[model samples]
Target: MRLFTIGFTQSSAAHFFGRLKEAGVTRLIDVRLNRRSQLAGFAKEGDLAWFARELCGIETEHALALAPTPALLGAYRAGEVDWPEYAARFKRLIARRRIETQLDRARLDGACLLCSEALPHHCHRRVVAEYLRETWGKVEVVDL
Candidate 1:
């Protein structure tokens, strides 16, 4: 399976959509906990859905299962936990949710995991990709 991850922050409108189109992404799976936040700007649920279809002819799906739990996010943002600890707990959360079993391989083949971070290094999207790759057989991940 082929998977891609991307962050909307620090990216211009043109660059974000262009990257997805260039990568041949057929679907974008939003992994953010809050999909309708005003801070999202062009990345907001409604805008993204429309832009995706219009600009790239791709579909978008929001999957809360891929987001970090509120408590986990709070802890990390509050500095109560570091990246490694936050990552471990998030991985455990995925395991507990059995996300692998719930995943649709076909839908994910050309899908990109979406988040707001500027990079995947400290993001839950990377954890999702790594966890799925580790437990669900071979998967090629590209951080777009």
Candidate 2:
């Protein structure tokens, strides 16, 4: 199985959708704690769903189960918790949720995990991908 990860912070509409198309992403799984944001522009929940369907012929599904808890995100952003701690806690959350079993494995084959960060390195989407990869062997992750 193959999974892709991407962030919209530094990507324009063209660049973002273009990369998805290039990756042959069949579905975009939004993993943001807050999907609706005025500052998200084209990446806002409604707009992104519409564009993914109309422009790229890709499906969009918002998976709140994949997002960090609001308090965890707050603590991390407030610098109360460091990246390593945040990452550890997020991974544990995923385990507790048993997200791997709950997720549709078929849907993940060509799916991309979406987040707000511009880079995948520090994003929870990467952690999600890694968790899944570890659980489901032979899984390949492409950071977009």
Candidate 3:
């Protein structure tokens, strides 16, 4: 299964949707903890859903578990969220456990992890992608 992670921090809804279409993303796992945000286009679940449907034909779902868990916060404070170690633990949860069930549902159509960050390398999606590579290999990450 090919997996993708996409960022939406810097792009307009058009650009974001376009990237997803170009990547042939059939489903988007909204990984942001706050599905609603102060950001203009991203502030509501229904709106994004509508946009995705109307513009890109790609389905959107919240990847609740893919968002950083509260436990990850405690680890971050203790400096445990550093790349290698956090990536290991996060990979196990996201790729090998119940979280995979959620991702799998998304992937039934083709899926990518989505976050508000515009840069994939700076987001938790990067960490997840690393875990994906270590375990699954040869996946693509598209910053929409």
Between prediction 1 and prediction 3, the one with superior lDDT is 1
Query: Candidate 2's residue-wise lDDT over 17-118, tens digit each?
Result: 999998899999999999888999999989999999998999999999999999999999999999999999999999999998999899899999999999
Residues 13-124 of candidate 1: C-alpha lDDT, one tens digit per residue: 9999999999999899999999889989899989999999999999999999999989999999999999999999999999999999999988899899999998999999
Q: What is the Cα-based TM-score of model 1?
A: 0.98
| Deviating ranges (above 4 Å) for candidate 2 | none
* Clashing residue pairs in candidate 2 (N, C-alpha, C atoms within 3 angstroms): none
Worst 10 residues of 1 by lDDT: 101-110
Cα TM-score per model: 0.98, 0.98, 0.73
Ranked by lDDT from best down, the candidates are 1, 2, 3
The regions of model 1 sitting more than 4 angstroms off are none
Error of 3 at 55 (Å): 0.4
For candidate 3, the 10 contiguous residues with the lowest summed lDDT are 100-109
Query: In candidate 1, residue 13 scores what lDDT?
Result: 91
lDDT of each: 0.95, 0.94, 0.68
Which pairs, if any, clash in model 3? Answer: none
Error of 3 at 123 (Å): 0.8
How close to the true structure is residue 86 of candidate 1, measured as C-alpha lDDT? 98
